[model samples]
Target: QEGVKRWLNGRDDAAFSRWQLSRQREGQFIDLLLAVRDELDRLYRQPLDEPSMGQRKARLFEQLRERYQQLKQQWGGYAGFDGWFSHDLNNAYLASIATYEAWVPAFQQLLKQAGGDLAGFYAASRALGELPSPQREQRLQALLQAADP
Candidate 1:
């Protein structure tokens, strides 16, 4: 009975430690998210102050591509190699969605502040001067299929 009680107490202490570690990780994740956003803001908004469409488009695309690269690196590590692989993926997905949400206002403000047509600029931005919508969708679908665990 005494041994069982000691084991239970040990388990409880370990569980509490794990819970604390999880909270610390969450805080770090938030910090990472904020840092990414700050990078995006610096890339997009600061350049827009001088008002160059080409530069704005380039900066925005660069930031978007960087985020995608970062996410893939975070999420797609080899099995049993990366300790936080699953956690990284989940955090990346959440961060990507949050970043998109953050962009809504920045985009709106850019259009209003710069007196540009937001929809037209965005449509052009989406095109990225290459493949059409259908081809892009097909490529994305293929990538998603490939990415499945």
Candidate 2:
């Protein structure tokens, strides 16, 4: 219970939102998620003050790529480990990596044509919008139910 409490990261639910554990074991998976979240928040909070598209391309995207790389590393270890958490993380990693891989080139091209206009980059990037949640998340949710009280 002590470990699970820590794993919950102070959440009352204690559920992974994707599993109803009969017993709590090592909370490495949740810890990894927290690490990923912290890193993302760290990177996202940085103000991208690059005034020119070239600068934005060089600096902002470098940071973005770095975040993705961090995620890739986080998910890589558990990709095929044959559990719901591993499955979910790996799926997230794969989808996010693929989408970002495509977007890097897209952003580069957009920056080239953006004529130093951040709005142009914004307009073009906004076209990509939000991607649908990966199927694995749903599967994991279904797999999770109320834990035995």
Q: Which candidate is the best by TM-score?
A: 1
Per-candidate TM equals 0.29, 0.25
lDDT of 2 by residue, 42-145 (tens): 54467755465345434543454455445446655333323433332432463464454333444555444566466685774465344245653342233232
By summed lDDT, the worst window of 10 consecutive residues in model 1 runs over 77-86
lDDT of 1 by residue, 8-27 (tens): 55679876665555555445
Question: Could you tell me which 10 consecutive residues in candidate 2 have the lowest summed lDDT?
Answer: 140-149
In model 2, how large is the Cα lDDT of residue 118? 67
What are the lDDT figures for the candidates, one per model?
0.49, 0.44
List candidate 2 segments past 4 Å from native.
Answer: 1-88, 127-149
Misplaced by over 4 Å in model 1 are 1-11, 48-149
Clashes of 2: 0
